[model samples]
Target: MGWLFLKVLLAGMTFSGLLYPLLDLSISGKTRAPKPNIVIILADDMGWGDLGANWAETKDTTNLDKMASEGMRFVDFHAAASTCSPSRASLLTGRLGLRNGVTHNFAVTSVGGLPLNETTLAEVLQQAGYVTAMIGKWHLGHHGSYHPNFRGFDYYFGIPYSHDMGCTDTPGYNYPPCPACPQSDGLWRNPERDCYTDVALPLYENLNIVEQPVNLSGLARKYLEKAVAFIEQASTSGRPFLLYMGLAHMHVPLSVTPPLENPGSQRPYRASLQEMDSLVGQIKDKVDHMAKENTLLWITGDNGPWAQKCELAGSVGPFFGLWQTHQGGSSAKQTTWEGGHRVPALAYWPGRVPANATSTALLRYCSIPTVELLESMGACRLSAWTITRPSTLLGEPKLVMGARVLSNSTLPLSFSTWKTMLQKLRPYREEAPSTRRCCQRSPGFLQMSFKTLLMTTAPERTTLRTLR
Candidate 1:
């Protein structure tokens, strides 16, 4: 009888798994989610061990832990670039920074913008009949050719760029000496451009601006509401959907809030993070309500915190340059030390991705190509695939960084190789982190650049220019 019961249990599990596609296609009148509806929840500038699941022993992060237990954790996930615009460009294009001419932030300087020819994840999904909508920050571009509408998103609703960008070309939407032109009544203007406020909100429904979002503390609820509506609509229409919800929290002016605003804010060190966790909880509830175990959810950060803000403003936490430097590299100052590039990365899918599967596998953001996703839906064939760094291909006239630099390519180390790299890099590893000891192991293809060290006036600052 016990054996028979075991057999029945196996049969039940098998039946459920197999029934998913048939029921989804037939009764529901919709195609099964192709490789799951991908949701990349990009946090602003959180740390490597900030999540509860990653540092449960010391830190008090609950919601993130629950997520890890139910999904897969990429112990070694990497960002495309160290900053937001370039990093995001790398993600959407599936190419490294240089190829897209956006290796730097677009706010302060004009060094980067998404390329025109590059196909976006939305366009790919749209081709395969997946509804694509961006519900958060759209920092990629602001103009016609470069906007999300042009890139691939069928629907777009989010802030144009960083809230911290210098004041706009026009003030108060119009009036006294509009920077250059009075523009028109159609343009947007916010007085809180340099400060934090819930008023000067930037809101979009589809292509039209419906309202200006205020009180970012409630941004999560807004996204969740939109996501739920989208999922419901997709469920009714019987087509797969891709939802990219980027949150703008744990980043900014750092004001205290209610429990709902910051769930885990009790700890002085990472209060905003706790609030962010609350936002995560709301998202999870919506997913469960939709019963989207077949959906894929990927969460990560935009870039390291404002290093200077961390130092002077008391907003950013411990990450070296989270508040200051354009982007603090993963590990250390100037180089891909792991502090900036190797921050938090998590993926979860119900009834699909193996639960508790903590993958140390070297995963790059560029790997999520639109074609691959479409292929899963039997909608497209692999015409071609190239993994070149975009920033290098289009921009940088001199291209002096990588070509003339001539740095040794260091592969990610295992238990043994890491020890060797550590021994080789010992002089600079002294001030790594106050908590965990640096592991002797790294990703398989982990490489370090000598340019940072070689350029610094002294060998003491050799670690300044580590590679990403």
Candidate 2:
């Protein structure tokens, strides 16, 4: 089953690459323009409800909401994985954890990152003559060859891992509130606090450590400055560029610039969210000024908020995952629940993407369609397909008709679907021993089945049903 799934995933990626040019030609008309600059802004630990446009109760993301209004919003977009490293690896490689060899978060002291053999999106774009730069958190690998520079990013800036992973001069606002790094050479250990205080967080510029024990308060400003400069430089050079900004806004140890209007009224998380949104707005403005008609700005989160952070974490909105919560475990961040994987996604391209549109088609990280979209843009080739009508690239929900459905009597389904199916089969709350065992082991089983479903393609409908 594993081997078959791997082959299907590889085939899907290859097929997507081939189909992307046709989709691109359908949008850009008969005369093709230069390759579009791609700006992908990735939020760390941001929830599906964090974007104000997605959920009404949370009103911090003004700029992001504006972006959504002027672009296409995806309601059913999901991260490749629930955790950090694996999700990031999948995003860059267009492969799952099983194929990418990164199933969990990489440690600060970890020697390896995403395996060197795997090709990255940046690498592909770079090969196609695009300038690639990555700013912000890069948790894939920090050591020698596993670094972003080695991974095909022309230039790299920001922390090697999560901000909270190591102690810094300005620790910012965490749940328990971590202390500042000691001035003395000796490492500071707090028996009461669970946060790290020994090694200081280092800020990187390319391969060099520009700042040790980075000032959390000033980091946002620095990131904005660097990102804007990169975009301007690349635009002036007349080369299509790929700028991947992995933001640190919605994550813990929230460092927010104080609001001028009301200093003490707002929460820290909301303040930080506003700061993040403002930074995005500034970047967007820069893109508009330099290359509005030829750049695609895509924004999304790595995964859901860290539920363990309580008030500090972002809201998950409707994906509360009540079934898991009833069993006394978190359904956010590390779990396979909707709250853990479902994230807010927006795509903005002034004349290219349809404005104020929403798509409900189910999508996950490293999906064939996404890969096709990126490769189509990066490859910069137009297909024989003629542009007859105005439409957005991946702006509408894609329907796959006449496909096969493979299922077992106890099929692995989505959380909501699984609940309905389970109730029809047997009461989940009061289940027999065999049923309980099946339910306990269904998360991983379901994920595998879901991937297979996404990759399967055929001429005629075929149902593979088996009795367990």
- Identify the candidate with maximal lDDT: 2
Q: Which candidate leads in TM-score? A: 2
Query: Using Cα atoms with residue i matched to residue i, what is each candidate's TM-score against the true structure?
Result: 0.62, 0.74
> Cα lDDT for residue 442, model 2?
32
RMSD of each: 15.6, 12.8
Cα lDDT of model 2 by residue, 1-468, tens digit = 999999998789768797577666787655445777889899999998887766767678888888887876766567878888888887777567876798989987799999998877787667667899999999999999999999989999999999998888877778788888899987679776556787888999999999999998889999999999999999999999999998988888988764234535767788888899999999999999999988878888888899989888988866666557768877689888768887888878877766765554333222212222333443211121111122232222121221111111122222222112212244323133222322322333112122222121323322111100
Worst 10 residues of 2 by lDDT: 401-410
What residue runs in model 2 are displaced by over 4 Å at the alpha carbon?
1-32, 258-264, 364-468
Against the true structure, candidate 1 reaches a TM-score of 0.62
